[model samples]
Target: MESKLSRNEAISQLVLASSSPRRKELVASLDLSLPVYILSTDTDESIEAHWSPEQVVEQLSLRKANAALDLLQQKQAVETSLIIGADTIVVLDGDVLGKPVDDDEAKAMLRRLQGRAHEVYTGIACVLSSSGEAQLAHRMTKVKMKPLSEEQIARYVATGEPRDKAGSYGIQGLGSTLVDEIEGCYFNVVGLPLSLLSDMLATYDIAVF
Candidate 1:
């Protein structure tokens, strides 16, 4: 069998502008065998309260990608690297939910989401350092959570799985049991939308098997 890396030209040397282990794992699962260089961008994600969730994610992703590009330039590495940056946010009833600040915050988020459908929006940005061209896109997934009793929320919070994740939950981890259904790309909820990322990469002559 051919090596997975040999099957695609577009993703052979992709850089991931994130430190998210979940995003890394999701990209690796594509079997592309590409080297992922993690360069966390120091971009402020605070958006105007009036901005929609989709817009917030998109802007953040672009900011991250640009920051990574600047870092690459400072390193004076070869200018052919393709950098990918992504951001995800959870939205409930027009409110943007980010990582929980504390255990109590996580519990509150879970309580608000209990037995309700919320939207998960993931924004992706791809930049070609040499050409200075970039592509941006957003993917939204609707997820329904099963009703959780007070005890359930407290128990889950104790596990500490929801502290570092948006909306205080991680669908790919212990939080999976809380999700009743998903209406779109499962990977999007996990962190990055591989299908959409692949599509965007393809535009730059990158391919994934």
Candidate 2:
């Protein structure tokens, strides 16, 4: 069989401008042989607290991509590199919930989500350093959480699994038990939307099987 990457010229590196392990795993699933570079940009995500969820994520993703592109340009190692930046946020009743600051905060977030449907928005941006072109896309998934008792929330919070995740839950981890149903891309809830990402990458001559 011919290689999926055969149509594209080889990339010097695939730079991921986020510190998310879930994003890394999703990208690795593409099975590309290029080196993976994890570059976390210190972009401030403090928005006006009034932007829509989709707008918030897309803006953050773009900022991250631009920051990484600037860094690559400064280093002058600007060979053919594709930088992928992503941002995920949980929206409940028009409020954006990011990672929790404490166990109490996590528990509170989970309690609010219990028996409620929320939206998970993930923004993806790909920048081609050689061409200075970037593409940004956002995916939103409606996720319903199963009703959880106080004991259940306490037990789950004690596991310390929700502290580092948006909406105080990790859909791919132990938090999966709290999910009742999902109405869109499961990978988007996890952090990245693989199908949409594949389509986006294809525009840059990168194919994903």
Candidate whose lDDT is highest: 2
Stretches > 4 Å off in candidate 2: 1-11
Predicted structure 1, TM vs. truth: 0.91
Among all windows of 10 consecutive residues in model 2, the one with the lowest summed lDDT is: 1-10
* Residues 10-63, model 2: lDDT tens digits: 567889998888888888888976788888889988887678888888889988
Residue 102 error, candidate 1, Å: 1.1
At residue 170, candidate 1 shows an lDDT of 93
Residue 208 alpha-carbon offset, candidate 1, angstroms:
0.6
Q: How does each model score on TM-score? A: 0.91, 0.91
lDDT of 1: 0.86
lDDT: worst 10-residue window of model 1: 1-10
Local accuracy by lDDT, each model: 0.86, 0.88
